[model samples]
Target: MYPKLPSLMDTRIPTFLKNFNLQAFEVVGYSAINAKYQADFCHVSVKDAVMKGGGRRVHGWALWEFESHIVGNFHSIWERPDGTFVDVTPPKVGTKVIFAPDASLKITDDGTHQTLYQNRTSDPGLPYIDPLGNAANHPQWMLENSNPSLIEYCKSLGWNNASMA
Candidate 1:
């Protein structure tokens, strides 16, 4: 039998927050996993256009462990249940992915930076966040922008969501 994988909530979340000096935030959404492939990791293409003139994009077959707990602009956690967070996105290149919730909070805390575009209309009840842009939205972005071959690969793996799962 396969070993039980650790939960992202129990492991990676704390380390991600502590590493970046961020406060805990709610999990917004997540890609559904197929029961048969529960322990297997999938590759996803994440777009990092938030930094430096539309930014560069990276494509690879790295195992993706996604969690949406933290409130920010990042899409995937790239973290293993073993508490290792990998930044497979292009923003930091080879560095580990860090959620900059503190930076996001600072913008929201400062009223002057407020703008309607920054606030997510999907969930109106929540406080305004991501004055710059939220990486949290990137998974969907990746799905929307992904090629047909990648989409087929994801579907074959039982990623049922319209977006990458």
Candidate 2:
């Protein structure tokens, strides 16, 4: 059974510092100007935009929906001087993205970005431990709740903790 996905209003969202606003932004005219793999370098793109002109960096999470779960990946976007937010990174597919701004989250030195995963359905029959965004620190939780593919992906990254029982 799948765990139900939490909305911004859900009290279960751990460390959810603020309401996750549903946002849709346009990719800037020069989004791909200096970006290599645009989709993978959102932080860089936003940073470059801020450096080039007059805009502040906005930190938040970008939500990606999968069949089994919805993942919220820590991300950054650009807020123009006019107070309008825009994604300076070229999206991999569609022009739109689901973004949630969290003023509290920021890029850190560890280089290990955080991601939150929530089940698509709330099935009480299943073991419904809430998914932690920082699975790298929770080996046991990773083994139990994370999908097999994700565990394998972690292994490829040399995350030995994920391989532990």
Candidate 3:
């Protein structure tokens, strides 16, 4: 049997996201847009969808996994006129994503987005940290060990720190 997935309202969610009123949406699969790499082009794909008169774009956080921890990745999806949300880009894992919508944030030319983390591993050696204060909430290891180009791209996006690599 599969393990239970946590809800957006789960108590384990970090304090920073509590006030945002995050919601969970099911991943609709690969988008119909003709992008070279669909998985790597969420922001653009959603934009294309809207430009083609498909649906309006909605910006928010999508749950992702990094180094065994659940991370809330800054992501975007297409919301139909009928009020249904669809994940235009494929998720890194699972069939659904926990999304925290923030309509004020818009997608820019640069590929920049925020990330939040929750350490669910049983290992007591690595305790969870809130507001991961070391610059855009990115842990030092992620910055130092990730790809340099990705890091530079994040900087261009105004993250003030490298994340989501």
Candidate 4:
């Protein structure tokens, strides 16, 4: 084993948050008991983008436990230097989120940790929370300008629930 990794504070938690535009991730389904959410059905809320949910916390800040259940990737969706959340996933707009540590596991008795990689194609896939500058939307900033179709698209995707996209 490489060695038991330290707490979120001890690890590279801060740097990760600085990079995130909002929430750490977009959780798509329930993994422990069963997968209740489908690939297309899950919609995580983002923070501070002004869709519905919106707010900004200090960097490297620690959020609550429930904040984690929605997003699972811990290794990648870590924290920021100011102690706020740095969401790598497509953020919602303004939802306060925290890492759900229960979503992850240590997987060893010796103490070292191994991260389980996740993606849209994988089980418990990665949630696409990136709300801004989507080239597919044409010019990306269309989100800010509030294009008619973009508004409808954002509504259909449940922008209210997203944390920081």
Q: Order the candidates by TM-score, highest first — what do you get?
A: 3, 2, 1, 4
Name the lDDT value of residue 22 in candidate 2: 36
List clashing residue pairs in candidate 3: none
Query: How would you encode candidate 2's per-residue C-alpha lDDT over 1-165 as one tens digit per residue?
Result: 322324444432332222233333222322444434256556545665676777898866555443344445556778888997787776654554556676655444222322332321112232122344322322122123254654454444345433211
Pick out the ten consecutive residues of candidate 2 with the lowest summed lDDT. 119-128
TM-score of 2: 0.50
Summed over model 4, clashes come to 45
Model 1 residue 136 CA deviation in Å:
15
Q: Each model's C-alpha lDDT?
A: 0.31, 0.47, 0.50, 0.28
- Per-residue error for 125 in candidate 2, Å, reads 13
- lDDT, residue 29, candidate 4: 20
For 13-85, candidate 1 gives per-residue lDDT tens digits of 4544554455653322222222322221222332211121233322221211323333323333333344333
- The TM-score of predicted model 1 comes to 0.25
Runs in model 3 deviating more than 4 A are 1-9, 14-16, 19-37, 65-70, 109-165
**Candidate ordering by lDDT (highest first):** 3, 2, 1, 4
The clash count of every prediction, one per candidate, is: 6, 3, 0, 45
- Residue ranges of candidate 1 with Cα displaced over 4 Å: 1-22, 25-43, 46-71, 92-97, 100-162
Cα RMSD, each candidate: 16.4, 10.3, 8.4, 16.5
Question: For model 3, how does the per-residue alpha-carbon lDDT over 71-135 read when each residue is reduced to its tens digit?
Answer: 45556788877878777676555656666575645433223443323322212343333334122
| Model 1 weakest 10-residue run by lDDT | 107-116
What TM-score quantifies how close candidate 3 is to the native fold?
A: 0.51
